[model samples]
Target: MSNAAVLWRRVVAEAVGTGLLVTVVVGSGIAASSLSPGDVGLQLLENSFATALGLGVLILMLGPVSGAHFNPVVSAVDWWLGRRTGAGLTSRELTAYVPAQIVGAIAGAVLANLMYAKAAVSWSTTDRSTGHLWLGEIVATAGLIVLIFALGWSGRAAVAPAAVGAYIGAAYWFTSSTSFANPAVSIGRAFSDTFAGIAPGSLVGFVVAQLFGAVVGVGLLAILYPDAGRAADEIVTPHTDTTTTGATT
Candidate 1:
């Protein structure tokens, strides 16, 4: 097959993987909320487990195809860091991946809403626009990016499914905003007003904070493992993990 065809396959993988991931996240949150009414803690626990397990499974299933980024930030960062290494997405590939992931995320939220018999396209009114919330997002996203890239550098790519999932699950309780680490996820979650949604008004802050976190995460990777990142040059840089999803969201 041609190179374009290969990239297209990866693009499709990203779209499908991100879509299902969002669906799992939103759907689980809805189910958890419904089942554990008036019990916020229990609902969160339920959401976190389902999200963590589903994310891990999706990564394991689709990592070989698209590196399982599913997040625009992940895809963009991968392209930037791995460009010189030749083990990353091409500019063309990067362009394709981000939009596909975003579209998939939106679709996933809509699907979840439809499944639960809610308005399929209404904006979320969860209003998470606090400064501290943005700070939490930055912290969560930075930690995620740092973990994923560091693992790739250390040649422990196989641990991603478990480690990434665990970090998100843990970050949920620790972070005030429940760690909406993925931009695509933030966008998707904005569409739902249920237990897992974020207000559209807060999208900018969240996304900007995430991007800032990505920068910090990548910088830390460069400083801490100056030589380790070189190892990712030869193999596909598998910096894996995401901020959005029921588990982390």
Candidate 2:
């Protein structure tokens, strides 16, 4: 396929992936909150599990097309790792994916609102007394970048969806930030008053931490697997069609 076609595919994949991801995250949270009002924590746990599964499946389904970015941070990290698509993306495509993700996230949040009118849409605010939340964000984001680089290096980018999903679900409980790992998802969740919301001011800290974490993750990958950079120069000859959804988790 031509580079232009590939870029367009990437944008569409971002939109679909973001839309689906938001639907799963917000929609499931809304269901859990309604069904188990007294057990908000458990509801979040349930949502995380489902979100992980959906993420894995979506990755498997769409990784071949658009490289299954779904998250701007992932795209940025890929660029840093030297694995972003070539002609590579111009500022225009980069701009396109982020907005697509943000808009798609908003659509998901809005849809959840329509679906669960009785439930709260905005996330709750707390003092965040646990200092671990920041630490968790750092670790989670770093781990995410490392995994992406590793997958790309091993020429197993096809399974990124499942790999990412599993990481996200596991990280939710393990990391203090509940693995709000993706910047776009974090921003989208802010729109809802549901269990997932991040306070308006809080986004800055979280995003900064995530960016730091991504840098740390990729930095380590560079240190540990320096040869991967050389390997990255070779074009990845995709075995499946761009639209193929047979990827593994």
Candidate 3:
């Protein structure tokens, strides 16, 4: 496809994938809370599992077209990892993507909140004490990034979507933060005062922890899969030169 066509496709994929992710996440959160009142842990678990399934499906559906970067953190990390080594979205395009995700998330939260009366939607308060919550965020986000990079970027794993789904589902049980690995998703859920809300003040800790986890994941991947990143130039440079030679000849 032409560059313009590819760019448009990528944008559409991102928008649709992100929109679906947020909607399902918030919707599931609300559903869990309504079904099981006062059982915050179970509610969060349900939300996490649903999110994982939703994300996996969306990624599988959109990975071929746009890489399915439904979160800004993933997009930024992919760029930093040099995965966008060749003709990909520009800074301007990336800048636009985050806002679209945030907007979509907010819309999702609003719709979910409306589904279940706003008054019934209570903010999250399941032992997110300052210290414990921060620690949980760190562990949760780290695992998520590791899974994404390992299965999606490394190209060694078969059925990346299934791998990601399992990782998320496991992370929810293992990590204290219940596996809220995406900063955008975390912040977006905050808008809805439902089972997913992080108590506005809690957002800072979650975002910070998530960013730290991303950096850690990148570092670990660098060490564990050093050659994974080397493919970009090796493939692109040779292909470009070959094309040029063909044109000249």
Error of 2 at 208 (Å): 0.6
- Per residue, candidate 2 scores C-alpha lDDT tens digits across 104-130 of 777777677777774435554633334
Write model 1 residue lDDT over 113-228, tens digit each, in one string: 99999989878899988889888898898888778777788788788888888988888889988998999999999988889999999999999999998888788878987644
Model 1, C-alpha of 129: deviation from truth (Å)? 0.4
What's every prediction's RMSD, in angstroms?
A: 6.0, 4.2, 5.9
The residue ranges of model 3 lying beyond 4 angstroms of the native Cα positions read: 83-90, 117-129, 230-249
lDDT, model 3: 0.65
TM-score to native of every candidate shown? 0.91, 0.83, 0.79
Q: Rate the local accuracy (lDDT) of all candidates.
A: 0.81, 0.70, 0.65
- Tell me the lDDT of model 3 at 133: 69
Ranking of all candidate structures by their lDDT, best first: 1, 2, 3
Task: Output the lDDT of residue 23, model 2.
Answer: 78
